[model samples]
Target: MIIKRVIRSQNRVIVEGKNLVKKHIKQGPGHEGGIFTVEAPFHASIVQVLDPVTGKPCKIGVKYLEDGTKVRVSRGIGASGSIIPRPEILKMRATPRPTVAGPKDTPNESCAGEDTRS
Candidate 1:
């Protein structure tokens, strides 16, 4: 399972486990508490960030720019071999912005609570 979030202060990382364990808690006066199914934390050493280019878990490598700015790169064999910032990804979407979701403004009911939604 991959790590979903990292809690550095507590030195723990929340990873997607095989199953969600339900934990019960007593509600305090100021807390809206209940039985919650939350992602359990694992050892930080076991967690690894995936390479955006190859989509594989690998050790992160840092390379400095000419102006002394540090950048992270992937060591994946199938990745683009370059000392760079972010990988190049082209998302060729089928639907453009205009055809996609947006607030449909009706001409007549431009005032008050006449919503122009389906």
Candidate 2:
């Protein structure tokens, strides 16, 4: 009796594993004289799948055909707008502006200390 196995991929995104494994083998003697196997799957639900079209994580749906084959489909984005690093922007712009005295006039005594420090 032959027992067929159905194994789901563990990667969040589908990847060319054997080609990558071959590249790794050629790069170094590590895992020498042995075939590198892909990592085993955890629960499929635990992974967040990314859409290849748009660079974002998307909801996945599996559809079964009448011939008993499963096709994975990716649903599009949830919220629209790109994520911004607000704190980083604030930090970069947080520098204090220098107080401008008259063109010929010297800066105040407070700024005299600053000039000495530099």
Candidate 3:
């Protein structure tokens, strides 16, 4: 299975959404009291970064650019041993972007900030 993403890499690099084991837990202060699937750590030697273009698992190689700058190149088909651009990973918004809520055409025009709490 393809790795969704890498959580962390150290002595044991962790691969996300892999080898998950479900475990039950009682109601706790922080926890919501339910079963959760967590990623298990795997050996760093086994996991390898996939090729940028082909998306296939391949060994990484360093090649020099015309500017004399060394860059990583994917040794995959159609790659032609060319320098690969750094992958762009768009970060997800922690919270959804704030939206403006337009008026609902209520009976009164000045009731926009009226509190309806009991």
Candidate 4:
């Protein structure tokens, strides 16, 4: 199953076509009440990462390369022990840090222990 999203704080993941649940929405202002089918979050430990080379689910282990770069590899039963490349989405930042301070941003002087309320 493909992982749709990860809830790191809760140690849960929403896997595609897994752990489906029915959500009951209450009627509220400008909202309609209905029963909706949605993907529920499950413990991350319950799922296994598939080995890219073997195309089978396998336990993952951390391996360090010669250059000291750490990577995840398949390590359990019938494992091919191939390195697993990180998904591109995981490398992307959900919200990039602002390069320039906005109007609501605190001035650098105050942040650096300088009193701005003189």
How large is the C-alpha RMSD of every model relative to the true structure?
A: 14.9, 19.2, 15.8, 8.2
| Candidate No. with top lDDT | 4
Q: Could you tell me which 10 consecutive residues in candidate 2 have the lowest summed lDDT?
A: 14-23
The reply for model 1, stretches above 4 Å from the true place, is: 1-4, 17-38, 76-118
The residue pairs in collision within model 3 are none
Best by TM-score: 4
Candidate 3 residue-wise lDDT, 1-118, digit = tens: 5555554446465566677778787898876888878877776679866666666677668888798987888785545555566555524554776465546544554677888889
lDDT by residue (tens digit), candidate 2, 1-118: 1112224354333233311322234444554554555533234355454555565676766666689865666664562233222234335644666677667776577565465543
Clashing pairs in 2: none
Alpha-carbon TM-score of each model against the true structure: 0.44, 0.24, 0.48, 0.63
Per-residue alpha-carbon lDDT of model 1 for 12-109, expressed as tens digits?
A: 87777734678897888988778988777766887665766666676667878799977886666665544534534324544566744456754544
Q: What value does the lDDT take at residue 93 in candidate 3?
A: 52
The C-alpha lDDT values of all candidates are 0.67, 0.47, 0.66, 0.91
Candidate 2, backbone clash total? 0
TM-score of 3: 0.48
On a 0 to 1 TM-score scale, where does candidate 2 land against the true structure? 0.24
Model 1 steric clash pairs: none
1 or 4, greater by lDDT? 4
- Local distance difference test, candidate 3: 0.66
